[model samples]
Target: MKVGLIGFGKAGKAVANVILQSNEYSLEWVLRQSTILEHRHVPEFLGIDSKEPGLIFSTSSIEIEELLSKHPVDIIIDFSSSNGIYSYGKAAASRKIIIISAISHYDEDEKQFLSELSSKTIVFWSPNISLGVNYLMFAAKLLKKIAPWVDIEIIEEHFKGKPGVSGTAIKLAKELDLEETEISSIRAGGIVSKHEIIFGFPYQTVRLIHEAISREAFGNGVLFVADNLADKKEGFYTFEDLLSPYFTN
Candidate 1:
């Protein structure tokens, strides 16, 4: 698949490396703010070797559109900020390009815009793109079916710099039909990410945990979803939707 990427931050860098290393996808274009391009280690930060070819970088939507006109891509994976999404999503949707966004923390207006955009093109949006976290969500749903009366709580831990509750925790709580307050967030050290779902009964408790050893796990998950989405029909989708096949088996 020919792929375009937006953002060159940590997660974006990871995703870029995965695409570069993969034989199935080609990294055709990257979009980032002009400020990010000022970094001295642009190629190194994007995991692109000096000898690599066919990768275009741009800071404007018009440039991205021009590139798409010259070289159409099968999918566009976005790891940009919420503002970036707001800026670029419409352009991609107008061309009926598939978008896979890993951005979180959207305001009401942004959410509404994305919702409307999905009708015009396939949009897979999720805050937590890790396969393990998505599987955890699946497991939480099963646990709810097996023990509906059990009280459930989500505990998530991330690096101190991470803001708000983990998106995986919020998804888990949503899977179990619980409120955000039922999820606890812990910020410490440089932990990549960790989440635990606890099921409490009168005399016994059960816990399901997933911990990321590295960011590559998330990169792999993102690629997996992109591959699965190749045949999906247009609409807004999520990581949970990707778990449908597993649920049947």
Candidate 2:
């Protein structure tokens, strides 16, 4: 499969490296707002020019569409911000290309846009793409199923530069009837990702924790999603869906 990456940030770069190492896919094009020459190492790190990389730098939607037409991408993995989600999703949907975004929440406008493409295209969405977190979500469901009496609380912490609460934590809290549970966040040095789900009773406490020693952990999940989703058609899918193959119990 040929892939088109829509963002060049940390997560994007990490996913790109994964694609390069894997044998199943190739990097077709990387879309950005600046020329390749402007950033000295962007080309080297992205394997640009090594195998004749197709780097696209454009601010116009028409230009992006034209580039996609020329290259003919199978999937567009987007880690772009919230503002770019609607426009990029629309553009990719208009072309019937598959899209997977790091941003998860969809307002009414995005919902309508997705509804328009019901069977023709698919846009996989996830707030957090770490496979470990997906496994944690699965565990949460199992705990709820086997011991629904257990009370659950989720806590997540990230580096100081990171912003916002863990959408996954909130989702888990809401799922386990603990949305009102105390959520503690920490912003400190050298931390990538940390999450702990605690279930307690009078005598014992059960804890499930997933720690990310590096950003590559989350990026690996994104690459896994991109690689596995080439043949799937229109609908909303998540990292949890990707882990379903191993979730048989």
Candidate 3:
């Protein structure tokens, strides 16, 4: 499988590591800004070089677009910010390329971008791409059905270097119809990411939690999606869509 990555941040680098290690996929190109090198030594830290097979770097969407036009890719994974995502997403979707995005916020153009490609291509867009979170989402749905009246709250923690609160927790909150502001966010030491959905009522309380001990946990999910995406028929999808049908009793 040929794959391209957008953004070279913590999560992006983590996913790139997994893609490089996986025998089933190849890293075609990484779309990032030229000044990204001046901002931080990403390539040195990550040991990425353009000389490597299928490895290329681009500073603009036009550069990436030209690269893709010359060499079609099976999948393009966007782990970028809202602004960055829109630039690449438009081009990827235009070519009907399967896109797996882990961006947090969305815009009207971004929404319409996905809408246009929803039927002809497969696009997986979610705040948290972790498998554990998706499983947690599945569990939450069951809990909501079984214990409809349980008061639920979410708390999340992330690295201080991170920009904001846990997008995953916020996403889960949205999924369960909980107020986004009710989902708490914490920034501390070297913690990668952690989230807990707590349910409490009169006498007892239940908690569903998934903690990421390492960034690699996220990489696992991205790799899994990349592997499965190659064979997807075509359509907009979610992590739940990839998991085999399972029920809670």
Q: How do the residues 55-141 of candidate 1 rate in per-residue lDDT, one tens digit apiece?
A: 546564346667678767878888888877776677789888888888866677877888898999989888878888888878888
Candidate 3 lDDT over residue span 1-249, tens digit each: 788787777788888777777777777667676544432333445776532254446564346678788767878888777767556666776787888888866777877777677776788877788888788888887898888888999998887877865667777887788998898888889888788999997888889988888777777888877776667777788787777544422
TM-scores for all candidates: the values are: 0.89, 0.85, 0.86
Q: Root-mean-square deviation of each candidate, in angstroms?
A: 2.6, 2.9, 3.4
Q: Please give the CA lDDT of all the candidate structures.
A: 0.79, 0.70, 0.76
Ranking by lDDT: 1, 3, 2
Q: Count clashes in each candidate, considering only residues at least 3 apart in sequence or on different chains.
A: 0, 1, 0
Query: Which structure is stronger by lDDT: 1 or 2?
Result: 1
Residue 116 CA displacement from its true place in model 1, Å? 1.8
Please identify model 2 stretches exceeding 4 Å from their true place. Answer: 34-43, 46-56, 60-62, 104-108
- The residue pairs that clash in candidate 3, if any, are none
23: Cα error in model 1, Å? 1.0
What lDDT is reached at residue 77 by model 3? Answer: 86
Best by lDDT: 1
